[model samples]
Each structure stands twice: as structure tokens, then as C-alpha cells.
Target: MEPLFRLALLRPAIAQDPDRPSVELAQQTDFQRALSAASGAPDPRTGLRRVVGEYVAGPL
Candidate 1:
């Protein structure tokens, strides 16, 4: 889950931004991770872990 996603869970207003830029970006980030995971392994957890690992370790 993303920061915005967590925030959304805590405060739904984050998902209701007028322009929705943050929401859109979060969704896009989620899509990228999902796509990466889906194409990477038979076990989704393995693939998702790889992606998340890279995300956490990669340059920001």
C-alpha cells in the first residue's frame, strides 16, 4: 500500500482531491506494481515482494 492509500484509509478526503492528481499518481503507481508483479511470477507475492523491495531500495 502507498502513503496516499494509507492516508486514504485514515482520511478518505485524500482520495477526493479536486484535481485528483495525488489519487491518479497513486493509482498509476499501483498499476505499475501490479503489472510488474503479474508479469513476473506464478506466485503474486513473490513478484510483488520483488517490486516492493526494489521500490524501497531504489533511488527516490
Candidate 2:
């Protein structure tokens, strides 16, 4: 999105290969759709924990 260009950063995105180190440059439509879908996302941790297992927070 425009914000990324301003910050000299690419849009946040998920890579196709989970084990690969890569950042997908989110297309405009994808960004907009993500924003809309997450507008009211609740209990996100529940779903995340399912895939990634018990949470472990690093020292602050």
C-alpha cells in the first residue's frame, strides 16, 4: 500500500512456503481485503495456538 512506499517498507504478508524465509509484497486488493476481514477479528489467539501450539512470550 501507499504507507509501505512512504516508509520504504513492503506491505506485510504471508509467504507461500511456511518454512521459507520470505516476505510476500501484498498486492493492493489483498491488503484491502485483509484490512476488512480483520476489522473485527476476535479471539485470534485461539486459532493461532491451534497451529503454533502453546504460546511462549519472550522476555520484555
TM-score for each model:
0.39, 0.23
Which tens-of-lDDT digit does each residue in 1-60 have in candidate 2? Answer: 687586656556544876663775555764345454555468655545543332234223
What is residue 17's positional error in candidate 2, in angstroms? 45
TM-score, model 2 to reference: 0.23
Weakest lDDT window of 10 consecutive positions for candidate 2? 51-60
List per-candidate RMSD values in Å. Answer: 9.2, 13.6
Residues 1-60, candidate 1: write the lDDT tens digits: 889789878964534556655435445576496666566677878777777787778777
lDDT of each: 0.68, 0.51
Q: Which numbered prediction scores highest in lDDT against the true structure?
A: 1
TM-score leader: 1
Model 1 stretches with alpha carbons more than 4 Å out: 1-40
CA lDDT of 36 in candidate 1?
Answer: 65
